[model samples]
Target: MRTRQSVCARKARYASAAVALDAAKVAGLALRPYRCDRCWQFHLTSRTKGKWMPITSLYS
Candidate 1:
């Protein structure tokens, strides 16, 4: 079932993670599927790698 989180994020909901991954590939977006705790539905998100820095770092 589709969830409100999907609607809010403007992303399509898939029946399974595999389906979502397929869709992401078809769309040419490097995305990873993850289940939302709030909605309990699979959603696609871009895979990013970075370290969290303090807000003050931006100005320094």
Candidate 2:
């Protein structure tokens, strides 16, 4: 598994992009998959609906 500076980063490998989309729908989160340049794997990220915020900010 790899880590990203972005707080909302979540990585998961599915057989296909459609499968990933289905999983995201089941979780009730709006997500889309893109090919990672470094790892060359698919990663799902939340659709940007508002201003970008770091996950750490929620704790502080």
Candidate 3:
């Protein structure tokens, strides 16, 4: 599990939940992409960070 300081709790939880739900929809013996919980969390963190930084920089 890669820890990124910029990640927040809410987004991480949401990402995890979404990923789990999606995985359930197609959880039948397959390991191609391997887009599991961790991947989803990392993606969400980076995406959120990407969206947040630019807007925040404007005010500072």
Candidate 4:
């Protein structure tokens, strides 16, 4: 009976691990490439908007 219980526990652990791996895979795919004002690939999404607003008054 003790061995059966241990086997069941191990199976549960493996199931939880599989679930964690699947979650990570889905999360990885949802990641987007952030486009910064400088157009650098190093920056992620920023909280402040209008980071790319161009300087104007050249329409004269």
Each model's lDDT comes to 0.70, 0.63, 0.38, 0.33
TM-score of 4: 0.23
Better of 3 and 4 by lDDT: 3
Question: Model 3, 1-60: lDDT tens per residue?
Answer: 554445433432424545644553465532112233443442222123223344554464
Candidate 1 regions off by >4 Å? 1-9, 50-60
Model 4, 1-60: lDDT tens digits are: 122444333332212434544544555632212322232222222133544433551232
**Model 4 RMSD in angstroms:** 19.7
Taking all chains together, each candidate's TM-score versus the true structure is: 0.59, 0.51, 0.21, 0.23
Superposed on all Cα atoms, model 2 deviates from the true structure by an RMSD in Å of: 9.2
**Candidate ordering by lDDT (highest first):** 1, 2, 3, 4
Candidate 2 lDDT tens digits, 1-60: 344535324556665777777887888765766556555566677755664656874565
In model 2, residue pairs whose N, Cα or C atoms come closer than 3 Å (at least 3 residues apart or on different chains), thus clashing, are none
On the 0 to 100 scale, the lDDT of residue 24 in model 4 is: 40
| Tens-digit per-residue lDDT, 19-58, candidate 1 | 9979988988657777876566788877445634457645
Candidate 1's TM-score reads 0.59
User: Over the full model, what C-alpha lDDT does candidate 3 score relative to the true structure?
Assistant: 0.38
Mark the 10 consecutive residues where model 1 has the least summed lDDT: 1-10
